[model samples]
Target: MKGKLKKTVVLVGMMGAGKTAVGNALARLLEVPFLDSDDEIERAANMTVAEIFARDGEPFFRARESEVLSRLLAGSPCILSTGGGAFLAPDNRVVIEEKGVAVWLKADLDLLWQRVRHKTTRPLLRTADPKATLAGLFDARQPVYALAGITVESKPDYSIEDMARKVMAALSGRHDVMEME
Candidate 1:
């Protein structure tokens, strides 16, 4: 059954934290639309996020990210997955908090590394020592991510579905955000 969502659910966390995958499943479970901020940015720019970062630099990309986030958050409620750095910007955080509910998909460094180590698509992880960079990023972003409205712990044993359900469960407690009938 479809659950009613009064506000958009914005999935925030580190890269490879399953924001896209879990957000897709959460949208399915809720019977609502699923949107990815990075995908939207790519579509609008006619290029991938990595390309945007490489060509225009992170500052330009972040400016566009904030614009896309505001536009998306203004729409009807849905499950919106954001890039890892999207929530780090204070302006983005303010808009997101005003328009949607942020959910941090918390996972350990080892788990995040296991998921992203082999992936080349992550521009931030293109570093010479990505594991170290990822560790630094994870440590730095934890406090900002902690500011999210909800927290869903993720472990290796949790399938995408399990994570989605856990997110749903967290949302259930906030009557202003979700109400499953």
Candidate 2:
């Protein structure tokens, strides 16, 4: 019951879960344009994400996220890396599911923490114990991510490039043809 196979690839995951990195690699591998939702928001807002969070708040940011996602879907043959919370929004999830191949980049809590700790401006992870914070975020968001057609478990031993290749392979019918690449 899937729609027509557009060449667009949408990557979803938590912040610092490497969506941008992996999406870039995947875009290069597929030779498509790579679009990062956060970057698009920054461009449209004329401010950094930290500035947006400090001045406008999360609801505002999410609204911008939805706007950017919609515009991205209007195009074709592209790879998009969405904000960590994009899929949490029902409307955004529906748009992505209908328009493109949604791939969830899954990572363990520890790896997520290690990747994100150096970042000081994650509004959600500003808690005193970010480890517990990340675990809670993961618990809350994992089910939403599961709605994606593809789930890629990322680990230290495997590079994002590796996962991107796997995604391509899966999409090319080397894996489950019934599933999205």
Candidate 3:
């Protein structure tokens, strides 16, 4: 809580894993900017993420996501939240690896489903069976997310503030990533 971040703390995980929410709290705790790649993409395209996906398709959206990530990473260290699929791309991973510390907010499928089930903002979840799709994505992404520099587990009982503090605690010991003043 009393430190200068040494590099961007990139939050990577599923849509409902609290990347954006935790990133904002963590950035406030660290006294730095909080940036979300999807927000940036939406801003640039003048459309919401779902709109972009619906109109241009995921490949086009992903290309823009990579562009946004690169631009965000090039700036000073901050809390950066990425889309769920951003880390799946090797190029984005390489850029984040070289320029930032990736922290995966790991949550179980059930936890994710509970958080996202009522939400309509998620384009990927709009399917015949969104729960099944989420489960599939969760299974496919876990191994890749495990490659992150640090991992903070997400539990149903943990509030957004609690998750943020957990991320801060993980970063606290890594002086190369975040150094206490």
Candidate 4:
């Protein structure tokens, strides 16, 4: 079934919460465009997220991220997947609240670690104890993510499509954001 996306759907969560994967699936299911803020940042800077972090530092990258988010949110509504740290910033959160519906893809720490551990792409997990670092980030970010407009629990056994369906179900109740036919 297809539905109208009245506002952009912004997926926010820790790195390995399947924001990109599930956002892609959700966009396909809803017949809307799918945009990734990190990809936009990388494209504009001609650098990967890790490279941006390594060279320009996080504050610089974050500034670029907020700029990209503002640009995207000002455009047509779509499914926007953000970097792990994007939603933690108050300004970004305010922009999202005004232009999009934020959905926290809440996943347990163990599940997040399992998905992100083998991925060397995550700059934040490059620490000596990556698992512990991930746990720390999870602890610190959960409260901030809880401020999202909606929460979709992501379980270890759930496939990307399942998570997307769950997100759709969560959005179904918000008539201002979604309309099912």
Each prediction's total of clashing residue pairs, residues at least 3 apart in sequence or on different chains, is 0, 0, 0, 0
**Per-residue lDDT of candidate 1, residues 47-161 (tens digit):** 9999999999999999999999999999999999999999999999999999999999999999999999999899998988999999999999999999999999999999999
Q: In model 2, how large is the Cα lDDT of residue 133?
A: 88
lDDT comparing candidate 4 with the true structure: 0.95
Tens digit of lDDT per residue, candidate 4, span 59-102? 99999999999999999989999999999999999999999999
TM-scores of all candidate predictions against the true structure? 0.98, 0.89, 0.98, 0.98
Residue ranges of candidate 2 with Cα displaced over 4 Å: 1-5, 174-181
Scanning candidate 3 in windows of ten residues, the lowest lDDT window is 172-181
3 or 4, which is superior by lDDT? Answer: 4
Off-target runs (Cα >4 Å) in candidate 3 are none
Q: What lDDT tens digits, residue by residue, belong to model 2 across residues 86-110?
A: 9899999888877777888888888
Whole-model Cα lDDT of every candidate shown, in order: 0.96, 0.81, 0.94, 0.95
Error of 2 at 133 (Å): 1.3
**Cα RMSD for candidate 2?**
4.0
* Higher-scoring candidate on TM-score, 2 or 4: 4
How much is the lDDT of residue 59 in candidate 3? 96
